[model samples]
Target: MHNINYVLISLLGGLIVPLQLAMINAFRHTSGATQIQSTFFLYVGGAIASLVIALFVDGSIKPPLYQHASWWMWLSGLLGSFYILCIFLAAPHIGATNTLLWVFLGQMIFATMIDSSGFLGMQIKKLDSLKLIGLGFIFIGGLIMIYSEYRHSSS
Candidate 1:
């Protein structure tokens, strides 16, 4: 069974995403920063916070074995930056709930693919009928959310 603590932590992480996006939006408005500038500041803050956490957890930041690292490993930071930029651009126009609904739906779909395929050295988890059903429900829910958001915005 999955650890309850980890599950709760994951849920908390999910909760934080929308709040973070909203805060970033507010920050941009208050600071009069462009989206790209705000994203840059966000990464700078994140890097400092991450470094502090690493130091606390590991006693020091140890260098990775660069020679053994795959080229794809370097793409994580770029991918994360792109994701943040997309969120920054999208949340204000779409509303956070609408943006997040689609984001969550996309994450679920792609994550399922990754798990099933065991891509990037992940442990293979066979995708079954139950998982497909769950994804279908999520997709339906996303459609409902889209409809609601459209009605709310238009009217």
Candidate 2:
């Protein structure tokens, strides 16, 4: 329950995002496979590994509250599929740095909206000017990245 532990775990999770995308992009490129096909195996491998871990840790395949889960709870698979497909399609052309920069920026903007509105069962967290200014900084950074990429390509 300590804040330090939570932050460490969050840092680890954050560190994995770009690495995961890079691995996915590399796999797609080397295997000469379609995004859907590559993404399918990624899901399958994740499911298998998760199942193994769950069985060892919890000693059961089913969650305690599976019966009470809402239909929307199952949509993460669809969302993840689309996310992977987008990264796979975009990373090769734009480079992973630019792709992840824009992705993180979008996440910040939309997450601010989601948090402020308390959408989808999340707790309401009001956004302030500081948060808006932070978002502006992120947008400006992405614009600079895009302009740089454009100039490099045009040259």
Candidate 3:
């Protein structure tokens, strides 16, 4: 069951990502929107889709907007916009594969640190030396990919 879930998760996310890239590329060519703008539009479209589902399927038209949230919590959209902007800008210059390597490495580094320390209310998982070294190796691999891209571009 765990393997099945993993396969399904991979299949769904893999399918969505290429579709997103195509949409981003099309938006870039058609609207001349900045990367940031395209990402915002993407989220906007997602929000619309969610609204339709909620209204027609669930009969609830809105999230509990009345729920409390910190300023930073509400600013997640802005943060995501910045991240997507970086992704679009980087992916064109560096190949998508290389860009993803950087993004994944960054995420791994931050997530591992947070999870290890129980930061931000995450359940603490003490990072043994083995895990730390393994993560370090992953980060090094990502750096190598970026370096390869740099070298290729320079040549």
Runs of candidate 1 exceeding 4 Å displacement: none
> Who wins the TM-score comparison?
1
What TM-score, over all chains together, does every model reach? 0.95, 0.88, 0.77
Question: What does the lDDT read for residue 128 in candidate 1?
Answer: 100
Candidate 2 or 1, higher TM-score: 1
lDDT of 1 at 1: 64
Q: Alpha carbon lDDT of residue 123, candidate 3? A: 100
| Evaluation by TM-score, superior candidate among 2 and 3 | 2
lDDT score for candidate 3 against the true structure: 0.79
> Can you write out model 1's per-residue Cα lDDT over 56-153, one digit (the tens) per residue?
99889878899999898999988988899998898888789878888888899999999999999999999999999999998999889888878988
Evaluation by lDDT, superior candidate among 2 and 3: 2
lDDT of each: 0.91, 0.88, 0.79
Residue pairs with colliding backbones in model 3 are none
Name the best candidate (by lDDT). Answer: 1
> Tens digits of per-residue lDDT for model 3 on 15-109?
77656776797888899997777887888997899789888998876555645855566776777777777878888777677777777778778
Q: Write the per-residue lDDT of candidate 2 for residues 25-56, one digit (tens) a residue.
A: 77888998788899898999989999999999
Better of 1 and 3 by lDDT: 1
Question: What C-alpha lDDT, on a 0 to 100 scale, does residue 150 get in candidate 3?
Answer: 84
